[model samples]
Target: MAVSESDDEGSDRARGKWRAKKKQRPFWQELPILIVIAAVIAALTVSFVGRPYVIPSESMEPTLHGCSGCTGDRIYVQKLSYYWGDPVPGDVVVFVGPPSWNTRYQSIRSDNAVVRGVQNFFSFFGLVPPDENDLVKRVIATGGQTVQCCDDQGRILVNGKPLDEPYVKSDFAWVSGQQNATYPSGRVFGPVKVPDGNVWVMGDNRNHSADSRAHVSDELQGTVPLDNIRGKAVFKIWPPGRIGPVRAQDPQQN
Candidate 1:
């Protein structure tokens, strides 16, 4: 029969090219492994589920602003909120520099300490990308807690109470409207007690901050030691219509 209909039309054209390569071979090998597992789960949800910061400085005014001296507010830094404890009292942080303020926002991957220890271990698996010269403040007393500056409406007491701070900077408070304010007079003097571990920061643009009030060698200092803090400032993703959520102004004490 014409060689059995040409071997049954060459076995039905080799079974329709083996069912079109078993249906396009899993849409091209699982589309690049599902795009590298959705880019490592969106870089571990932007490294520890929350990231974005862009407030160059104005220290944090009326809750945060920027641009008169440059580098103003554009904040968001809440990587799993201190895992569950530690930095409190109006918390707004982003720290990891005690080689003396590590050269103001000095990027370029912190001049590679083996790429900052493999970007702090894949920044805990966001797969890497973080460290913007580092320095962002807020958190007015922790550890042994005492932080003082003024009490009678000159405000700034914490552990002695009085912290209403609507995000100060419209005639400052937290004591320097006559605190005898002679820093280095006792090395960040005052009722300043926070020690036992460390943590006592301030800057709602307190008259244009110089945090911890000058003296880590006096450049722009104000006691920050809880291992140079590194977390909190819950949210403010970015101008995609002012994202949302940002907390830590004593959100239940630390």
Candidate 2:
């Protein structure tokens, strides 16, 4: 049971040498390790915590601006909100487009496998757009609610109550000649009962947006499944003049 001072000193010297070796590692070697760690963290953040999305169309205009030949608004979509509760009416959200809605969506990736692989890697870091058909819209009705267009005052009704949506930017010209426009789009549809676990969504730009209304004949009755929702768009982070929190006004609230 006797421990010698020489043995203890040898053990101490061995540990010191190892520490010195670690400290002497070249920056070039450490750089790769740091890069891999950072990449893993970025990937996880993009997958679960939050990610940035660029608005690709005018559908959410006056709320989120994106159009041809313009700087699109880049929004930060936070996944944490839905982890606490389901999306409510008026929450702006990003979701993968359903099959019916993606009929016209074309992937921007090149056909070459090597190029596509490079594109995929860059996309993981938010350097390039994702190849999927992702869309952004506002929740109009949730599971169990019946949504329909146009009261006498041209308002959308959800569960027999008219929604007061201040964010809507309708093409009033579409209804100009109508005697009493039933809806801003000048087209009437719905009274569609949203299936449980699905949400009826629409764009603020009613006349132009090909949202759930445009896909009503599809298998899911145009309602997006909750599972398709990527995240709640919490803030607009691009176009310095337009930077602000994305509104999540509950249209159902009186």
Candidate 3:
């Protein structure tokens, strides 16, 4: 059938209208949409895959630096590792502070709902520090193992065997401003057996760390439940000069 001239004109006009309706959105108008999309994707990545955490103290010093008047090291904690296996002895992990560990914690989060929501969003990208009591430490002993500090050579023992912890730094002359502030070894603690699904952790800056050893009097004997662990710290992502893979050296190997 031969097409009519009027029919052809009508089709052309319809096409023109469709094209006008589908014109590219202005860059400024599209930017907010782009921002929202990026934020959602980033939030999901931080929630399920990995996230960055800034060291808040000297607890894991030398191995992971954070202290007054110093640029804190930001670490990447990957959640996938723990999904396949539990944290083993020597694994550096980020976890929520248990009840006992939070006695001295004071959250910096704002009480105002609007301000807190803004903080929560920025926290995902690490612009703001997390307000919760999150801590990082090395696993000294896993479930069913007995952990205690100090042997004849002043070594921490797990399962009655001394751990050769090369990462431990008892000296703090660089930050503490005292030449004699170093401890020959970490403070002594119990031979408490870690409960099932729990781990005993300690900071690499042994003498200055308020880790599991400081909470032995707690109900769980200071061992953190495995469920409390956020993830294994895989890499140091900040401080250009100090970036490197965070070591999970097996202290029990010795």
Evaluate all candidate structures by whole-model CA lDDT and list the values in order.
0.63, 0.88, 0.85
lDDT over C-alpha atoms for residue 46 of model 3 = 80
Better of 2 and 3 by TM-score: 2
TM-score of 3: 0.83
Candidate maximizing lDDT: 2
Off by over 4 Å in 2: 1-22, 172-185
* Candidate 1: segments with Cα more than 4 A from true spot: 1-21, 24-28, 35-37, 40-49, 52-76, 79-91, 95-125, 139-148, 152-161, 164-179, 184-212, 215-247, 250-254
**Candidate 3: pairs in clash:** none
* Model 2 TM-score on a 0 to 1 scale: 0.87
Which candidate leads the pack in TM-score?
2
Per-structure clash totals for the candidates: 21, 0, 0
RMSD of model 1 against the true structure? 14.6
In angstroms, how far off is 72's CA in candidate 1?
28
Model 1, 142-227: lDDT tens digits are 77766666665566666777667665655433444455555433222456666666676766767666566554343223466766
